[model samples]
Target: MASSSDPKLPPLMKAQFLEAFNKPYVLRSVPLPTVTDPHDMLIKVDAASYCHTDAVLAAGQMRPNPPSFPHIGCHEFAGTVVALPEISTSPFQVGDRVGVPGRAFHPCGTCFECASSPTAEDADADPPGYSVYCPRSQNNGIDAPGGFREYAAVDSRQVAPIPENLSAVDTAVLMCAGVTVYAALKRCRLKPGQRVGIMGCGGGLGHLGLQFAVQMGLEVWGVDNADAPLRLAGEVASGARVIDARNVDATEVVARLGREDGKQDRGDMGLDAVIILPESQDAFDYGVSLLRNHGKCIVVSFPERGFHVSARDVVFRDISIIGSLVGSNKLLRETLQFAAQNNVRAVIRTFPLSRLNDLVAEYHKGRGGKLVIDMALSDGS
Candidate 1:
């Protein structure tokens, strides 16, 4: 508990706790987290966005290494720094606004991966976008107390300062969904004017991916089954070609969009890359089918069941299928900066923390846009 000297700090805080697997979350009062490690900071969370990963975790889907019981289960969040270690190397100060991604794994700085990767300008951190892959990474809300509570203790290396223009809600979404799509797009390495299709474009990550693809100068196609998602994608992304995956044959569409003879002269014919953002196996197959020879397909979603890919397609088409996790701290920072600069914002609906169960139910049903929990609100509100 923070001392009385800090009026804003509360001795006890409310948090949603998971007692065990396949159990409902228990919301109750708990002691606020304190800064123990030299590089740790105590953050007063402003907003925490719900993700499908959290839902999956709640269902006991991530077996073998699921979060230990009695844990908080949100990864994407943003807040203000309330306390910092007395002797710390972090540039952030108390009261600094910051956003945290799901897994902010700190690089050991001496590991093979870190040593081999390009060094940051500061020389202390790993190269941008590599820290998330560090072997000794710590995931918030899973490996430790998360932002579902009012105060969270986070490693400074995993926290990025939020731009002044972005609201807390938008920053929260960007922490997970934004950096994810941004990292996936970076993996594609598409040249300007290349065509890119985003599967599940109407959902949270999908919509953000579409905007990122557009901002990166790619001719974008938004693929989804729901009309609302398609309409929202068009509204926010602008100029994106919306396709109803339920009605259209994705393979045929790709064939018509790409050059049949392998001639490169056709303008934007055939997708240079397709980013599969949905959990549907059919969507994954369709994404692979839509790519031109030598094109790339980036898989960003995780379905409960494993999906099979044809080995023959990879061997013959020379198409690359890459799996992308959440972006590194460097990429997260870049995503925030890019979104702020480009006026790319997440469309979100805010709910009070008290309604967490209701929100989770809604999320399970699947909805358009992102769902964010506002910690400032009370249960009655």
Candidate 2:
């Protein structure tokens, strides 16, 4: 990986960005991050996805800037481990292809959460929400550079091996969206043959949820307002009952597709749960309305602050609504395996890494599906 100028080390990698906290990202020559720790490996990024959270970070909502001067934009990506400065450990090797989840960089082997419970946490334990933490909340972004760059240094523990058959673009989207929907589905306690409805079924998260639900043996009902998304939902999750949210009342639509008689006992045939993946308040409200007597409404989207839900209806129906963050390593690993085996992939548009500026602008134009950055485009493309 050495360039012509330096024989011992590679030329400084370039990162693209403008001034922090309100400027567009631009690529400039920068050093390729090194593996200073024995447990770290240097990976050449193959692909990365542009997430809504990336937009938030770019817009100055999360952290104004990473600890470093220039910032790279990418959190979810799949790449090959190009260098391992220490002994080979865990499941990864020198050239193993792996996908990086957002939380991978946060875990310190000595963390209280990881030390206390590897499998399950105490119900009362108040664990640090993010694995990557700082004494000041703002110091948190320094651990791992985002996935948009040509190379990234990541902890071996956070890496998940991807199947050779799966493309990096597919793995990149699954790192976040797939893990999110998987976490939400677990909260629903999906049972074999149970019915679950997913709102916003054609977007990044919703589409994956539909496939996961179908593979788990649940009857999936996908709800979306637009015809194109609904059509995509049908194509991705065959046999799923795709409903047009605008054409009919969701409650009525769910009722019609429910049981044989369109009615069931208090426990028999209403929706077991609803997974709301869209940021719309309407989706949240509709999710509650379409629930069965004791159904759970799981909120996976981060809506703007000051949003409200109806307290009275929730109390009367015994329906529980809970919010979920991305997921833990355990759940993320399971999601990767499931996605690898079941062929779940993000529908994506690829752009060369150098064209990131154009890509970001197009992303704002409401591109359908996920947008992936092809880091390998510098050489391979």
- Residue-level lDDT for 309 in candidate 2: 81
Q: How do the residues 163-250 of candidate 1 rate in per-residue lDDT, one tens digit apiece? A: 9999899999998888988888887877888888899898999889888888888889888888778778878878688888888887
List, residue by residue over 1-381, the lDDT tens digit for candidate 2: 321222444767656654575667777777777665566677888888887777667666664443354666677788888776644444667678998876646354455544453336323222453343323222112324677777777777666788777888888888888888888888788688888989899877888888888888898888888766777787888858888889879657656756655665543446889998877888888777777778889898776562478877577778888787666666777888888787777677788887876777877765346788887665334
Candidate 1: regions farther than 4 A off: 1-8, 105-107, 119-125, 128-130, 258-269
Give the CA lDDT, 0 to 100, for residue 268 in model 2.
41
TM-score of every candidate relative to the true structure: 0.91, 0.86
What's model 1's overall lDDT? 0.80
Clashing pairs in 2: 13-30, 16-26, 16-27, 17-26, 74-146, 74-147, 106-132
lDDT of 1 at 349: 82
